[model samples]
Target: MNKVFNTRYLVHLVLAGLFSFLVFNLTYAVRPSDYDLKEGDTTSASGSDDPDVYIINEHGYKRLFLNPVIFNFYGHLGGFAKVKAISPSTRDAFITSGLFRNCEANDEKVYGLESTGEDTSILHWINTTGAQAVIDDPNFFKKVFCINNNEFNWYLKGSDYNSVNQIPVYSRDTTSTSTVRVGIIEFVPQNVVYGDVHYAYLKKTSGCWLSSGGEIGNYYWVSGSNQSIHSSDCYDILETYSFLDIFNNLSKGISKNVQRTIYGEEDTMETLHSVYYIKDFYEKEALKYGVSDLAIDIDVKGPYMLASDPPLGGRWGVGEGVCNASLTEFFVNEAISRGVDESQYDVIAYVYLGDWQLSGRSYEGFTSCATGSKSFMTVTTWRLPQEDEGVVTLAHELGHSFGASDYYTSPCPQNPTLWSCVKDPEGIPEPNKIPKYPQTKGCLMAQIIAYNKPGSDEAGDATSISNLNQAVICDATAREFGWR
Candidate 1:
C-alpha cells in the first residue's frame, strides 16, 4: 500500500471535519538518522534505544520530560513509537529549555519553569487556561498570574504574601503575535504544549479484538485471513470521544460521561463524526465556562436509538411535554433505565430534524437546567433543525446538568454569580450578592432572546456563543466548582 495514500485516507477518515474533536496522530516508517523532527515529538540521545525523551518545542529548544508520569501526563504513552532515536549531534542541536510543565486536567492554569541558568528554575503561574490554550499565546496577561491551588490557598487564608515568597509576576506582553513574552521569559506558541493533549493508543495486535459491545468478537485480526474477515467485526470500537468532555464538565467543569448512538442515519461514520461534533461543541461550552481540563469520558453506543426513537414531540416546558408531566416522565425513565448517574453525568437524547415533528410547527423538547431538585430533563428541541444546531441545543440542556439556571427564568433575588441582570434583555436579575469576583463570564446561560432584545446588556454580552472563548467562569459558579 502507498504510505501516502494510507496516510491521506486515515487522515481524511477523521480530520475531514473534526479538528478539535481528533488529535489525528498518524505515523509511518521513521528514518531515525536524520533530524527530520516534527512538532509534538519527543526524542532522546542516540545510545540505548530509549533513554530520556524531551518534548520537541518551538524556537530551537526541547523541554525534557522529567519523569515517566509527567510524560504520560501529556499522553506521550499513546505515541511511544514516535520517540525518535536522535544522535548525540541531533541531541546537542536543540538547546534545553525548561524542566516541568504541570496542570491538572480540570484546571485552567498552566504552570511552567522560569530558569535561573542553574538546574533550578522558578515556577511561574501561566495566565492561560483550558483546552484551547495555544502552545503559547503572546497576549496572555494577569495580575494574579497563576491561580493554582497554592495561590488559591493564599487567597483562602486571607493572608498577604511578602515580596520574597511571591512567585515572579510576568507581564503577558509579546514582541510579536507569534511569540509570548511573560515577564523575562519569551517563547512562541510552538515553544510549549499549553494544555492537555490526549493521544489514544489503539493497535491491532496478534490478538483478539473487542467488539463494539466491548466483548471479544468471534473474529480475530491476528492473521492475514483473519484480518480480511474480521476487519469490520470490531470496527464499532473505533470511537471518537471528547468533549464538549473533549472540553464542558457541561458548564462549570466538574465531570461528564456522554454516550452517543446514531439514528435515522445509516452511515457508520456519522456516529464518529457526531461524536467529534458533540465533543467539539461541548468543549467550546467548557472553554466558555473555563473547564476544558475537566475529565469527560465518552462512550459511543452503536447504531440504535435508545428506547426506540424517543417521542420527543410537543411544546417545551419544565415538567412534561404537553403542559403535563408525561414529557419529563418519558426521558427520566429512559435515563434511569440506562443507569444515568444524575449527579455525575448529564444526558441528552435527540432526533433527526423532522423525525419528531407534530404539525407545521416542529415539536420541542423538555428542559430543566436548575429547577429545584430535578436532576435530568433530557430532550431539547427548537432552534435545532440542523445537525450543528442540534448539538448546541443538546449542549444547552446539558448545561442544566451543571446546575446553571436559565437566564430566562428568574429575575428577583438574583443569580449572584453573574453581573447584575437589571439591564437584562429578558428581565433583570438582581445584582450578584457574592462578595468579590475573581473570574467572570458573560452569563452565557442567558437565553438567546435575552441578548437579541432591543437593548444592550450593561452586564455584558450573554449570547456570544459564536464568538468562541469570548466567555469566562463567574465567581459563584467557580466557587461551587471549588475553583475559588
Candidate 2:
C-alpha cells in the first residue's frame, strides 16, 4: 500500500461500483487452422518496432506475458524457445485475451479476469478467507488476469469473488514430486477431444501418494467420464471424494502430469536408483524433464532400475565395473535372481554414478533370459553436462525400451513396408557387421546410443524421442507396447 502509483499516464476508473478493468478487443478473425503457435510456446509479431510476446492459452487465446519478470515467473513450466517470430498475419490469427502474469511480489492479493465478451473483461480481487485456490488446472490461470500496483489503481476496488463458474489452478502433490503448476495450456483443436492431461490435489504419507480425483477415481475428468468438460464445471464436481483415512483408500500406483498410474510395480522407484552419484545433478535436471513430460503422455517416472550397486549396495558408473556387455550380464543375473518376468514388458534402468561416456543404451529385444538382456536401459551422464540433458538422454533410452518386438526381429515395419540395415554386401560391404536389427542404419540403439557415434539420425529421434514430452510413439517401432 506504500508504493507510489503510476497513474500519470493512465486514467483511474471505478465502474459499476464493484469492478474496474481494461479492454483489449482485437478485431482479427481467426482461422484456427492457421495457428501453429501452441500453448507453453511464446511468440511475437515478426520484426515489430515494439515486440510484444504472448503465450498461447488452451482455447488458442493469446494473453500478454507482461514483461521479463512475469515471463520468468512461470519458468517452472520448463522452457521457451526464445520468443519465436510469427508473421503479423499469423500473430493476429489468435484473439488477444486478458493478462495472466502475476503482478504481486507476494501472494497477498490475486485477481481474476472474467471474459464478458470476446474482448471485454472485469477484474475481481480474490479476498475470501477460505477461498481455496483453483490450481487443479494450470491453464485456468491463462484466462484470468493479474495486475500490478501501478495498474491496480485503474481497476475494481471491491472484493467481488464470484464462487460460481470457478476455475481450476494447476495442482500437484507437494510430497511425491517438486513440480510446480503454471498457466501454460496447449492449444488443442476444437474438433478433437483428449482424455490425457489432468491435474489433482494430492498428498503423500507412509510412502504412498493419495488422490481423491484421478484416473481410477469417480471424478468427471480423470475417470474419462467427461474429459469433454476440459477442466470446466468449475471443478465443483471434483475433489468431492475425500478418503485420506482408512487403510484401503490410498492410490496404489501413480503416474504423473497428475495421473499416469502404474500399478503392481512395487520397485519402480524411478529417482532413487540414480541418486548416489548423479544425486545433486539428478535433482536439478530431473525436475525440468519431469515438468517437460507433462506435455506428453509419457511423463518421466524414473531412473529406477538395476545398476551395479543399486539397493543391494552403493553406486557405480558406466565402464566402472560394467561395460555394455558386462552390464547386461549383471542385469540378466539380477533378473534371474529376482525371477523377473520377461513377458511382463519390464525394463531395468541404469544411470551414471557421477558421469560416464556412452550416454545412453537400451536392449532392443529379448533373445533368452540367460543369454540376452532383460531389455534393460542405461543412461549415462557423460555428454549430458555439455549440452543435452541427463533426463532427456534417459527419455531417448526409454523410447527404445518401449519399442516393439518387431524393431530388432526379422519382420519388416508395417507402416513403411520396409526395413533398414539392408543385407547388401555390395553396398555396406560389411553387411554381416550390421546387427540383424539394422542398427548401423540406425533406429535400434540396442547397446549404446551416443552423441559421439558417427551417425545418429532417425525420424522418431529427429521429431520426438529426445524431447521429454512432445509427441506420441513414432514409426520403426510399435505405437503401442507389446503387452497391449
Candidate 3:
C-alpha cells in the first residue's frame, strides 16, 4: 500500500509539471508583446507610428491593421501620415516625365539609383562625390543576424552608425511649392533579396496648397543629413508601401482598381474606352476564346502613338510624356479613331518630362508616369519590340486602368525572383491579406522587361494568344472591367 501511494503521488506530480509547462508556452505564444491586438486571433497588426504593420500569415489568410489615427514618426514601417491633414487631391494628368520615357525629351536627372542601405551619410557622400566615393563596396552595407516574424532575419545594412545623426526638423511650408521641403531616407528591409527596389512618397501634415500624394509634383530637398535622410527615406518608402497596402485593405479595392484611369477613385471607376470600342474588341477576342459574348459597358483604345518617330537618338519612348490640358483632347481623338464615342469614354494618355532619356530598352518595359494632374502609360518604341510581348504589355497597362497591379516578378541585375501566388497544398486559394492569384510562369508581364528574341514579327501570332496566356491576361482584364 505504501509503495502504491508513493507511485501515485509521483505520477500526479509529473502530470502537474507537464501541465504547467504547457500553460507557460501557451501564454507566451498568445501574448504577442510586439503586436497590439490581444483579442481573438489577430489577423493583422498596425501602429500609429510604426509603418511596417505585422501581417498574421496563419495558414495563408492575410490581414492588415492600421493605427486608428495618422501621424508621422521615425522608423515607422508603413508611413508617416499626418493626422486629419487633408491629403492633397490627386491629379488626372495622363503622363509625367519621371515615369514614362515615351514622350519626354531625354533628361539625365530623371535617372537615379536608389540604394537600400542603413548609412545615409555613406550614400549621400557617394552620390555627391560620384566617382570619388566608394559607396557600392559590399563592406559598407554589412549584415548582423537577428530574428523577426519567428524567423532568422539577416540585415544587409549595418547597425545604426555613430556618424552624425539628425533629428525631426520639419521645414514643411504651405507657401510656394518650390519652398516646401521634401526629404528621403533609406532603410534595408528585414529581408533583402539581390535587387528588389521599393520606393514611395507622401504629403506631410500641413495647411498647404500641395504636398505629397496630391497632383504629381517634385519634392524639394530640405536640410538633409545621414539621420535626416534616413528618416526621409524611411518615410517615403513606407508611404509608397502604404499606397500599395491600400490594395489589400479593401474587400473589393483589389478587384476594382486593376487598371489605369485619369481620376477615378478605387471604388467608382471611370470609363476606359467608348461602348463601341469595348464591344468590338470583346466580340473579336471572345469568339477566338469561345467565351460568351458580353456587352461592353466601357470603352478602350491603344497602341496608337509611337513614343519615338524612328526609334532613334534614344528617343524611342519619348512621345508619351507630353500630357497637359491638351491630352484630354488627344485621348478623345485616339478613342474616336478606334470607334469610341468621346461622350461615353474616358480618354487616357501617357506623358514624360523633356529631360528623361535612356539608351537601351534592355532592362524593362514601358512605364506610366503621371503629371501632378494625371497618369500616363507610355511605350518604349526604340527597344527591341517583344512582338507578342507588346500585346501583353498593352493589356497589362490597360489592366492598370482598371486598378490591377503588376503581378510580374521584378528582376535584378544579377539574381531575380519569380512572382508566385500563395496557394494551398491542393493549389487552392490561401486567404492571404493580399489576394495573390497564380500568374503566368514566363509571361510578358511576369518577366521584368526582356525583349522578344530580336526578329519576331510586330503583329502578334497565334502562339501569342495561347490558351494559358489568354486566361492570365485577357480573362483577368475582363474580370476587372466587369465584362466577365
- Output the number of the TM-score-best candidate: 1
Q: Of the candidates numbered 1 and 3, which has the greater TM-score value?
A: 1
| Deviation from native of the Cα of residue 162 in model 3, angstroms | 70
Which 10 consecutive positions of candidate 1 have the poorest summed lDDT?
Answer: 178-187
User: How well is each residue in 1-484 modelled by candidate 1, as lDDT tens digits?
Assistant: 0011111212212322211121111111122234687766777776644366766644444555544544555552365676777775465445443222223234544354443432233454433232223211211221112122432332212122111112222211111111100010011111111121121122332443333332222211111112322344333222323222332232322111222232322111101122323444333233222222332344332122343433444334433423234544654565455554433322333222222332232333344332222323232121211122333444444344444445443332345454323234222221332422211224344423233222333453333232112222333333332222
Candidate 1 overall Cα lDDT vs. reference? 0.32
Q: Quantify all predictions' global Cα lDDT against the true fold.
A: 0.32, 0.31, 0.24
What is the overall TM-score of model 2 with all chains considered together? 0.23
The C-alpha RMSD of each candidate to the native structure, in angstroms, is: 23.9, 24.5, 28.8
Candidate 3 segments whose C-alpha is farther than 4 A from its true place: 1-291, 295-341, 346-366, 369-375, 380-389, 409-471, 474-484
TM-score of 1: 0.32
lDDT of 3 by residue, 40-148 (tens): 1322112222222222221111111222221122124334332111111100000000000111233221111112422121111111122211121111111111112
**Residues 1-484 of candidate 2: C-alpha lDDT, one tens digit per residue:** 0111112211121211221111212212233345655665677777655466776655555665544555666665444557878875455445454434345644455565554432234566543232223322123344454444444443444445433122212211111222111110011111212122223322222222223333332222122223333343223333322111110112211212222343421211111111111122222222111211111111122222333342211123323312346545554455555554333222333332222222122321111111111223222222211112333343334443333222232222322342322212221211344342232222222212211212224433222123221112222222122110
Model 2 stretches astray by more than 4 angstroms: 1-99, 102-329, 335-347, 352-389, 402-484
Q: After superposition, how far is residue 460 of candidate 2 from its true place, in Å?
A: 22
lDDT of 3: 0.24
Residue 320 displacement (Å), model 3: 13
Query: What lDDT does candidate 2 reach at residue 139?
Result: 31
